[model samples]
Target: MSVRSTAFIPAVFKNLTFWVLIAIISGVLVGHFTPETGKGMKVVGDIFISIVKVFIAPIIFLTIVLGIGGMGDLRKVGRIGLKALLYFEVVTTFALGIGVAAAIIIRPGHISRAGLDINDASDYTSKAQQAFDWWEFFKTNITLQALILAIIVGIALNYFSQRERIVATLYKISGFVFKLLKLIMWLAPVGAFGGMAYTVGKFGLQSLLPLGKLMLTMYLTMAIFIFLILGAILRFYKIRIMDLIRYLKPELLIVLGTSSSEPALPNLIHKLERMGCSKPVVGLVVPTGYSFNLDGTSIYLSMSVIFLAQLYDVHLSFTQILTIVGLLMITSKGAAGVTGSGFVILASTMTAIHSIPMEGLGFIIGIDKFMSEARAVTNFMGNAVATIAISKNEGDFVDREHSLNIE
Candidate 1:
């Protein structure tokens, strides 16, 4: 028994999920016990995210170029793009409705805002007052920029006489990039630790207690959406949601610890491909979904608006509520993967409505960091589901035993 137990310990230590989970727990303890040191650890997480981000553009460019160029079918590319956009629109609309519905029913904002920090929201609110420009959003979002350039280059590559040779070379580079990504991923636990520590150290858990109801409401709503709405959709495709969640557990934990989905973007692309989603579908759908198909951000945006309205006792008519949903369908697209973007989008929506006091935002700002983990995880899961759905719809999904093999 002693020999068997000793052998099992090394296997447990080898799992990335186990390490990441331990890091998160350790971070919380540090933040709670030694706040100043935890706050300074923010640089660790930031540096890690910055390092991971370096690969995002090139990976996206190569993957899309290879996916489209290799396929040699512009028509199919157009078909997949159209289907993905349509899927994003339909699913996100439901997400918006669910968020708004949950907020109204629960009325989490119907509480005292005493002692909550409202001043921390100034930067986001100031940005929100600026008119949301679709052109600017596209210009500033590096992921979308990479995606557009890749699509154009991919289409151009198909018409090149020497396309096959160039694609072969690009494939070799792609292999190196993914290999490098595997090595970089070893730091995920460290990054997770820093991110969690910074959040808890800076905000302190006690500061968030007053808004526990809002936190609970948001979490429960997202859980329901994931298991019920997303699960039902996957069921129709004969895919199990639990299976996908289990497969993506490591990535999800990274998102949870980091409180940002961008950390998991590259891994999601690789994992979706490993799950038998065609390269083109994974490349095109995943990046596009980051900007346009933000299920969790949409939910957060809609819910925040309703929570604010209820907080101030502002009565929103059915028509106005519908209008809010319609507006959010556009505004939420601008949130992207940027930190504090959700707040900016929420502020913009509040500004446009002219009813809810923008100051109400201050009430929730302190707790947003804690809630971001939930949002990021949901967003990560949502994008994964989107990729799989589009792949299956295009008849590009292949279920294979080897699909589960990931280094």
Candidate 2:
């Protein structure tokens, strides 16, 4: 590593992990204690997230092209991409199963306000009453979607690497964008803390209490997802998941505070590459994986469906839940990566089930806001584990002794 790169090692440890946690906790506490302060802090968070989103298109395009191009043989890279996606789908279903089991067993987030009349989710009624046109939704999130399609087209075009100066130029552009992203990423702590403070100031801890049980359950489930399931995967890969976490401490901290996982993309790719995941596997899987294989989203989909089902006294049959799971599998394919997207998917999912009233979403929307931090964090961790596991399976992994020495 260069002197400049070596210098960042200490800061990544000191500021990224522990200090970021302190900032997040303080913001939540302050937001809980003083709602207005939380509100103020929210503005900081919003601005920060906005800044990150401003670059999403380039980040997705470049990193993906670079990861794909690094494979040398586009055909082999495509095959690896397919295999990685299949693995993602299988694991995502497992996540769905875990969520279903948890929801059925514990039935967390049941509001006990009997004889109390709550408004059906009116705010999202627009979303529900709107037509269920997959085509429109497809068109909406089409930036990355389109880029993936283009990559497919390029594969068919199969212009040799020498002739395809396009790929070379894109690789250079991708490198430049990643560098710019890194420079801007230095401000991540500021953005994260500001976002956390805003979340606290606006919502207050009281807001969290409404969905406290649900959030706590999700958090616990997320812990189980990490330590038990992902831990096992890490062990299978002969990699310490904890070690990976340490490598990614800075990125995960930023994801936690801001509640948007996109900002972590550059770091995740670099870390996976360092871990000896082949560039093609890391590049293609990580970017496209953002869309298709969201384990965290899968878990939340099942849990939230049940949460709303009981919240409004709508008892769903076993078959209905099976259908909900099916719908989540389809819906998750096009799930949004924005902050509070779970609720949007929740809004859409509830509509698809045709049992839960549209207005029912309001019961949890207030509290759902707080839960997304864990959701985003878990989503990120799931992808990181996937990259490592796939690399191990593909024989691309670096030795743990070399990668996990922590510099």
Candidate 3:
């Protein structure tokens, strides 16, 4: 065999994307044919997520510390953070509006509510009824906690005479952690396989048929948001959203399989830096954005609320619709750290409005996992775009020639 052919063979076999795609397909097939076996694969996915979570806190801490400390500009750090927050709010609001509009147009909930499975949503409803506590949010949110501590430590280190030494030490640690992450990422195919298999096995494809309209509307709204709203934003920067999406194809697939964006967080930060976004910008914006700028979650939350209203044949006035959007602006921000946060936020929003039945959550709970793929993927892409946009706006972005050269 020729050397080129041998090399090509190895490259194809070694590519992460290749394996992950294959895994996803295999998983679906397994789930469809042998659900019992497929359901067992959840452990594989859980282990992968646990392993990934182990690195998340340290990586965030190290990246933020290194980025901020290296920059030695406390003011710039604050400015970048503030700007990212403002951008997150405005864009997420737009997402909420789009979701509401799409839900109204599609009316995914206009069908019969009878025969829908009703699960216990009391936990989410009760939690939503309570006042949101910032301390509780920070305590539960590891990434946000890491971001805050890292920022404070980074700022303090800026004044330390041995800041460079500390930064260098942290850099080495960061490299080691990334190396470990690279090793762990090889399990992504396994993780994806397990996650997909479990989801399909447990829920079955037939499960999606009942709520298919809501799912379709959710996906459509996300696509529109990405192409129209986010695309226009990227165009303003003279960049192509398609190019960026293509660049992050691997990460997006990982999120697609896992149905959670958390797994892709570290890689997203790394990719943004490689794309010539400043380290400080990537570090500060990405982690913070994970918490504050959940465009997908915002959309899902808004659309779900409207769907519930329609499901129960409850007529919502324009004033009530605006009230839901307003309430979501605040509730959505709390989604960062909570598990099953989308539903929780939905529950909370419904509870607060007192118009939508909280029990309606039970109907959508079964298919939330499938829809989550869209939410996670969109949230992941939104943050990626936000990081680059903020970097460009701050004059910290470096236009690398190779950024457009995606394989």
Listed per model in order, the count of residue pairs whose N, CA or C atoms clash below 3 Å is 1, 15, 0
Top-lDDT structure, candidate number: 1
Local distance difference test values of all predictions, in order: 0.87, 0.74, 0.86
Candidates sorted by lDDT, descending order? 1, 3, 2
Candidate 3 residue-wise lDDT, 305-380, digit = tens: 8888888899999998998899999889878622366776776667678776667777778788888888888899
TM-scores, each model vs. reference: 0.96, 0.89, 0.94
* lDDT (10s digit) by residue, model 2, range 1-407: 89999998887676556666777778767766776767777667777767777677666666666566555677677677788878888988889888888877778747664432334346666776665677777677755564666466446435564636766777778778778877778777777777777776755554455566777788888789988899899988667778778778878888988887877877788777776777767777777777777788788878888877777778888888888888888877666566877777777777667778777666666666567777787788888888878877878766655676553
lDDT of 1 by residue, 220-258 (tens): 999999999999989999878888888898999999988
lDDT of 3: 0.86
Q: Which candidate is the best by TM-score?
A: 1
**What residue runs in model 1 are displaced by over 4 Å at the alpha carbon?**
1-3, 402-407
What candidate 3 gets wrong by more than 4 Å, as runs, is: 1-6, 119-134, 337-339
Candidate 2 TM-score, true structure as reference: 0.89
Better of 2 and 3 by TM-score: 3
lDDT of 1: 0.87
